[model samples]
Target: MDFSLTNEQELFQQMIRDFAENEVKPLAAEVDDLERFPIETVEKMAKIGIMGIPIPKQYGGAGGNNLMYAMAVEELSVVCATTGVIVSAHTSLCAAPILENGTEAQKQKYLPKLASGEWVGAFGLTEPNAGTDAAGQQTIAVEDGDNYIINGSKIFITNAEFAHVYVIFAMTDKSKGTRGISAFIIEKDTPGFSIGKKEKKMGIRGSATCELIFENVVIPKENLLGKLHKGFGIAMKTLDGGRIGIAAQALGIAQGAISETVKYVKERKQFGRPISGFQNTQFQLADMNTKTEASRMLVRKAANKKDKKLPYSVDAAMAKLYAAETAMEVTNKAVQLHGGYGYTREYPVERMMRDAKITEIYEGTSEVQRMVISANMLK
Candidate 1:
């Protein structure tokens, strides 16, 4: 199969790279320090169509392919992982499910606004009691005369605090186990729906994450996403798509750490000579470059498979697992290469290290990714 990027893909990658370096990098530190959402930058991304890269133009997106989406995610992540998570959560977790499974009315009601970035979208699957076992979700939705009353809380939801819409999952039948779970579209302002306190996270500080509390929240029957008892399938499919974006985010963070390490080694003098002159440092840089390239290729392969409508669950899982672990490893080495400076906030490598850790933990933990890959292999 041909692997070269088309002219359009090349131009798209260049555009994202230029925007990240010129616009995002400048304000990343300030946003992180202040724990601000960077709404202005998010709006700018929307204007440039980075917020909806993979959706069709008719849905108010840039009408690009999954590869373009991954490239944009990587570039944005290199500059600011917070921005990358924002877009990834919006596109893959939220919009992808609706695009893939929603009825026409659901799409018409939600997709355009989410695609245009007029309002942010969030996906709710993980609960305080259930995470990797999403089928064990405790959130319940009971049918009530043309509406469903949802009751439960979702923890660790990305963009939960600021999102205008949410694609939520709740159990409709306890006896059916995984098949009992169903998906619903719930608006943020609906009665009995409120957000809990924002989570103080280890990294990606500029991205907002919070708890979603649903206390007998009523939603119209029309808001049901896909068929009842089919939410588990939708959630899994959505997460498979999300894994590719997370993998790209990991690649971007690794790239950023490596780039910083390279600059530091070149200018840092150790024992009367530049550290870059040391064979050990050179070997570390070489290994980092190789791993980063490999991670990028894995992400591209998974994305291409997704574009072709092929079974990409294994590819996506492998990409996320390898790339996230790679990010952690590279960032740790970057810190070591920088010596004492790497441990301080004075260097971006430290922050990158913290950001890299979450990539492994969220969007399915590294362990979960391994399980997915192994399960696929066994089949």
Candidate 2:
């Protein structure tokens, strides 16, 4: 099987990499330092069609595939993980699901705005009590005349205040457990729907993360995303794709850390010589590069499988698990290589290290990934 990227894919990768270095990198440090959302940078990404890489052109997207989307996320992440995740959550978690499951009318109404980046999108799944236990949903949506009254809240929502559209899940029939769940499309202006204060996070601080509060929020029955009681399956499927995006983010963080470390080692002098001249540094760099390369292959393999419309749940799980760990490990070594400087905000590696951590924790933890892999294997 050919592992080479097509010419178009290669060009897209280069284009995004250049954009990250020229535009996104300039504000990354400030964004992290001030915990500011880089709205301008996001606007730039949108202008370049980065917002909807995988959505169809007829729907106002670039008509790219999953591989291109993964590549775009990776390149952006190398400079700023916050930027990477914003696009990832928008594309993989929100737009893709609607494109796949929304009724024709829903698609016609939402996809154009989402694809054009006129409407930033977010997913609302994790709640105060329902994080990894997605089936343990407490949010309730009661069917009213021609509308559903939603009353519950979600915690740890990304793009909370910034998103224009949200894919929300709630319990339509508590008696059915996971089968009772359902999905809906809620606009930001919907009455009684509000965003909570932003959370002070350890990393990726530039991305807005907050809580979503719904109190007697009302929406038309037509807002139902898919068949009632099948939202669990839709969420699981969406997360399978989301894991691939996170795996790409992890791969980018690792690669970025390595890149920073390589430049520093060649210039940093110790004991009358450059650190790159030392056998220890050389070995460490070798190990870091090897592991990062492996992560890239795994991430791309998952993307390729998804592009082929093949079963990629296990592949995505493996990619996210290994790549997330590698990002953390490589960033740790990158800090050590930088010595005292790495510990401070003086270098981007420290922030990269901080950003790498969430990848392992979110979008299904490493433990969750193992469960997915093992369950499929044993079955």
Task: Highest TM-score: give the candidate number.
Answer: 2
Clashing pairs in 2: none
Find the candidate with the highest lDDT and give its number: 2
Per-residue alpha-carbon lDDT of candidate 2 for residues 92-112, written as tens digits (9 for 90 to 100): 989999999999999999998
RMSD vs true structure, all candidates: 1.0, 0.7
User: Model 1 off-target regions past 4 Å?
Assistant: none
**Model 2: CA > 4 A from native:** none
In model 2, where is the ten-residue run with the lowest total lDDT? Answer: 152-161
Candidate 1, 235-330: lDDT as tens digits: 989999999999999999999999899999999998999999999999999999999999999999999999999999999999999999999999
Report the error of model 2 at residue 210, Å: 0.5
TM-score of 1: 0.98
